[model samples]
Target: MPPVGRRERNKQEKLDRITAAAQELFAERGVDEVTTQEIADKADIGAGTLFLYAKSKGELLLLVQNSGYAEALVEGRSAAERIPDVLDAVLAIVRPVVECNRKQVDNGRTYLREIVFGDPAEPHHRDALALTVQTEEAIADVLRRDERFSADDAAALAHIVSAIMFLSMAATINRTNPINDVVQEIRDQVRALLRG
Candidate 1:
């Protein structure tokens, strides 16, 4: 890798501050309650400068949540690797994700909606697409390690599992159903998919 230049480093630092400030504010108050100006102020950047990083408050929330989701995926993958059963392993991978999103369920509802139906040109949509692909690859990797699932089948099955997970999570956005129940339901769905 080439050495980092001053301009690149400064840009990254600004992004880091923006991300940290957004996360803190969003957590303290819900996504809908936080404003772009608040985030910019917290980050010590001009409000106009914040727009250069994210087009809107929703995009800012998406950007902040993406990092948390990525970390959850890493933790989930590590936890899943230790499980002996493929079904349990997959649940391990998914549970952390649901937990992470549950913290900001309202924003999550909007985030998922934007991801599925938003403009292709939006940066958050692009980030979400990449995240989805990476998640499926992780699932496929786990399945490939198991004897029951073939490499060819693993990729397709990963897509199915992720779709089910996304739908299940979407359904829980406003409902009273316990998060564990949602996770268990997903586990059962995965088991049925594998058995078929």
Candidate 2:
């Protein structure tokens, strides 16, 4: 890889500051409560510069979430690798993402809503969708390692499982119910699907 230029490093540093400030504030105050101005102030950048990084609050939330979700997927896959059962393995894969949602439930709700249905023409939305596809691939990898399905079957099943997980998680958000209940329900549904 070519060495990063000073300008690129500075830009990344600024972006990191923005993402960290946004993540901390969103976790503490919820997304709807935090303003882009506040995030810019916290990050020590001009509000206009913040706009350069994320066009809207929704995009800011996506920026904050993208790396965390990526890390969670990696962790989930590693955790799943330790589990023996395919069903449990798949659940393990999704557990980190669920936990990520719980970290900033309000923002997570908005993020999920936008990323799932937002226009692919938007860069942030496209990046989020790409991340989701990577997650599906990760899940497929787990299934392949388990020897529970052919490569093609695992790829197909990964999409089904991802959809199920997202829908289940979406239904559970802000419902005044335990998150685990929804997760358990998803596990049951997935088990049924795998049995067929």
Candidate 3:
């Protein structure tokens, strides 16, 4: 592989350090009590430098969420797009979530609680919604690439997929409601929809 360009490498390093420090702090202190100054101190950078990488607490949390989603998206795209068959498409997605959830078996509850119950009033909420739309659009691209689903169907399915993902994340950590059984039922329902 080609060596990373110096600028890109430096930027990534900064982001990595900031995110690592923030994660530790978040895990230790929770989001409300953890401030940018503290993360900067832990990261060995000025407080202003922290905001350069992360605008607010919400962006910091979103950054962490996206870090997980990035790997999941790549694996999902690779596994799903590998086949012309739609069942393969579903596998690409289901397999990644199951795999990620398995890998995150320990961290899932902590991360999920922080993400779901994290501060929605933070400045980055609107931006997060925009990013969510873009993500759905990207997922839509995969469904659209298949000739099986029309634009309308693809859009509807994309919404369904996004809804399932959101609900899965929500239910995964619910105290009264573990999602393992529900996910299976939901998967069966979606499979029927996809088949129809």
Candidate 4:
């Protein structure tokens, strides 16, 4: 690979700072309470510079949450691989993601709102969407482990499972529920899906 130029390195450094600052502030206070100026000040960059990286607080939230979601998906995929039963493997893939999303409930819920309502042209939003696709792919891989499901069936079922997981997380009622309860709710829905 070619060596990175100074300009590229500098840009990446700025983005890293921005992401770290947003992550800390959002965790400390929900996204609604954190101001863009605060994030720029914490990142040690001018407000305009921060805008160049992320157009809005929603984008910053997307950037910050995307990394955590990716890590959780990876953890879930690894856990799913060890479980032999189809439903168990699927929930293994789900539990970590639910935990990650529930870490800061409002922030996680806001991230989901952004995924649904934010502009698709935005880079951070696109990254979040890609992560969802990756998640479905991970679940499909687990479903495929069962002999009854063909590749197409696994993929289709995985998509439904993804919707169930996301909806459960984003639901207003689940907002106050413990992460375990939310995850169990998803497990019940998924178990029924598998049985039918």
Q: How accurate locally, in lDDT, is each candidate?
A: 0.85, 0.85, 0.65, 0.95
Query: In candidate 4, which residue pairs clash?
Result: none
Model 1 lDDT at residue 75:
90
Candidate 2: Cα lDDT at 116: 74
34, model 1: CA deviation in Å?
1.8
The global Cα lDDT (0 to 1) of model 4 is 0.95
- lDDT digits (tens) for residues 1-196 of candidate 3: 8989999998889888888987787767666778888888988888888888777766776666555655776777777767676655755665555444434343444444444565655544444454446556656776787788898888888788766765654564533444465456556766776777
Q: Determine which window of 10 residues in candidate 3 has minimal summed lDDT.
A: 101-110
Q: Estimated TM-score per prediction?
A: 0.88, 0.89, 0.64, 0.97
> Higher-lDDT candidate among 1 and 3?
1
- Candidate scoring better on lDDT of 1 and 4: 4
Kindly give the stretch of ten consecutive residues in candidate 4 with the minimal lDDT sum. 79-88
Model 2 lDDT vs. the true structure?
0.85
RMSD of 1: 2.1
Model 3: residues with Cα > 4 Å off, grouped in runs? 1-13, 27-35, 83-85, 94-148, 172-185
Which residue segments of model 2 deviate by more than 4 Å?
Answer: 1-3, 145-148, 172-174
| lDDT of each residue in 71-129, candidate 1, tens digit only | 88999899988997888888889998888877777777667776787665878768877
Question: Top model by TM-score, which number?
Answer: 4
